[model samples]
Target chain A: MILVMGPVDELVTAFFLKHLTDTKREYLFVDERHLGGDVRLELDLPQGPSGKGRLRGAVHFPTWRVGLEELTGIYSRLGTGNVEQRKTPEARAEQAHAAALLDLFPGPVANRATAMLSNGSKPCQYAAILAAGLRVPDTLVGGTWERWEPFARALDGDPVIKSVSDERSLVKQVSWEATRASARPGQALAPHQFQQRIHGTNIRAHVVGARHVLACRAETQALDYRHPDMTGHTVSLRATELPEPVAEACRRLSRALGVDLAGIDLIEPPGGSSRPEDWVCLEVNTCPGFMWFEQNAGLPIARVLADFLGTPLGS
Target chain B: MSNQSTDAGLISSQDLPKLAEAGHVAAPTVGNSAAELREAVQAALAEQWSLMGIIDTGKKASDLGKKAADALTDKGKEIEDKAIHREKDARDEAHRKMNDDKAKKHGREAGAHGATTNAFARALSELRG
Candidate 1:
């Protein structure tokens, strides 16, 4: 049996659940949205050395009492909050307890909460990627314009300025001339990331277990392809092969980050260079939105994820 | 009750490693072994050549051979001096271009600043009304 943890209405979750149903697999879709009909949790962590730990719990809904122990695999997409409509103290406590309990399940979880914490910091993620033998852009993180101005001037080409955190920030190319004019006193009070801009086409690889489903987007005039100009040259997505070393790097990086599934962003330089050292890994998205890539490239990412979950731990 | 079943509730550390390994996770090579091998071979050849020179140390250069060697050394020095002069000229040219680019950029920025200040003043006056 498999446990799918996340909002069931989410497209990725819904698609995977459909495949599981077609295969007649015994699975439970556990979301905070469907909590507390008669839901209760019981966990026993024995005290003595000889004592064995046991977790036996059930969520009693109107129609089913889903046993937690029967789960052999788990795919968790649980974001940061509880399913409760109102944010009460009791609801928060229950949500915390439920999240912790699920962490104890210990089967082949797609990603553990502890492992996913690295995504919270871009610097930490870059360090992990470097250690995994992947190349990362030279970065400068600073809070003051006095310090940032020199670094920006030293770069050969335009540098990319973005937020240091995972929060959505427009990745804009720094034009020293324009920025110098728009500069306001105390503007650099907040920390910002200054990365050496790389020139290349973007390649996003959805790595499901051991499989790498890669798609390449054509070069665009926009700094970020997500917000492309409609009248200008349109960006195109096509299935492509990753250089062997890059493919290996992606796999190693995913393992090092302790995420079984990941969406790895790689910058493939022009002239189609396959040398591993030439490619730059931008970032690894632990929970990437697959609907856009799936709709564009016609890749069966959901089916791949479902098959990976249904398979046994060592098989 | 000692429940030794593999289907027990939680995944153990031992179980997690097996899952990662079983997935055929790519283990990238830490260093270029082929390049290392080539370097090793080159060092060995260099040592052999040095040893061969030691064995032939008794060979002496003739007076004519010595004169030719000195002439070649003088020619090399002349070529080296010209190369150095050319390199210096190239460096100076590059430095000049960089300074020019910086000046042009600063001029553009100053112009933009003037425009921005004018726009801000206009907006402020409109808001006051």
Candidate 2:
């Protein structure tokens, strides 16, 4: 059985529920800790189509002392709390606590809380994906006043700066480059992640099995597609298989992070830099928007999930 | 003092030390009790929400709010894990079944898959084994 741990925002929860049913799967969602433990396992032990099914049981542990006899797999989807609602001190503490708990799971955890963090933050994710021999963009993460100023000054006004770790985490998500951006040397009030923005469409790689890479490109407003003002681009989902090395890297990254799967986001920078060595692996999403990506990418992710858990997906 | 209580004029952060000095504050509702403060803050926020929106989530409780606040303080990485588990269960399941079957059919391939994709392929191979 698999367990879901976050508050399960209404929209995200509804999407998963729909997919769970569509894929002929059932889940035990846990947001609060019960008397014994705070965990939820999506049990499917009932003897049904697979014949190998057993007497099912689902339980979540605030700790991982419990057994894993009927266990099959696990998923981590929790994220930092909403930002705008929180205050300064509360926000910092909350994010730090979230990071710690991310590091603190019961047993058989995926997505290392430590591995998930980086000095470069999201840029580090891209670097890791690249180092794993995957296709990634020619990205850059700079905070040095001298080093980044040169790059920023020369670039077309719209480069994307992903704040390392908890920078814009709480505020409106720092998804893309600012619409009205201004850059002055030393104007960086806080440390920031400045990557030479990719000018291609988004490719959301829903990496499950080793070679099982469901790659799909999403449309957005401008070059850095995730920008808030991106409404002109109409999303058209299609499944594009990643090359062997890139696919292999997707698998390797999941392994390195201790997660069996991830939603690896990438970009095909404008030029023919589409080669394996040229593509930029943006970030690895531990808890990606399954419904949104599926809708945009048109991958049979729900079905894939249902099959994984021995239930029916998109059922 | 909690944020809500402070907002309600029940007790101010400055008054907290005085209240403690007067031996009026409880263990779970004071300066060191960050959780209690958070609850009060949440309640205060909720009250604001009540005024801004319709205030439908029921009135916040001092005790419950404190508990939530305390949990919030201590809930570090668990938040991310919760997010993943909550959203990815369905997909993870389907992934398990297909990969597990792949394990039975293609051991070496599954091994490579696991090596490449972590336990995803490894678990599939385990099922096969």
- For all candidates in order, the CA lDDT equals 0.55, 0.44
- RMSD (CA, Å), candidate 2 to true, equals 17.9
By TM-score, the best candidate is: 1
Enumerate the candidates' DockQ scores in order: 0.01, 0.02
The number of the candidate with the highest lDDT is 1
For candidate 2, the TM-score is 0.51
Error of 2 at A108 (Å): 7.3
Q: What clash count goes with each model? A: 1, 62
Worst 10 residues of 1 chain A by lDDT: A45-54
lDDT of 1 by residue, B48-77 (tens): 323323323322233244456557898756
Worst 10 residues of 2 chain A by lDDT: A166-175
The residue-by-residue lDDT of candidate 2 on A49-87, one tens digit each, is 322333233343333322333344434444322211223
Q: Write the per-residue lDDT of candidate 1 for residues A81-170, one digit (tens) a residue.
A: 112232555445555555555445445566554455555567778987887677788888865777677878888887898766444344
Candidate 2 segments whose C-alpha is farther than 4 A from its true place: A8-10, A22-26, A33-67, A79-115, A118-120, A135-144, A154-158, A166-189, A227-234, A269-274, A309-315, B1-129
Docking class of 2: incorrect
iRMS of candidate 2, Å: 18.4
TM-score of each: 0.63, 0.51
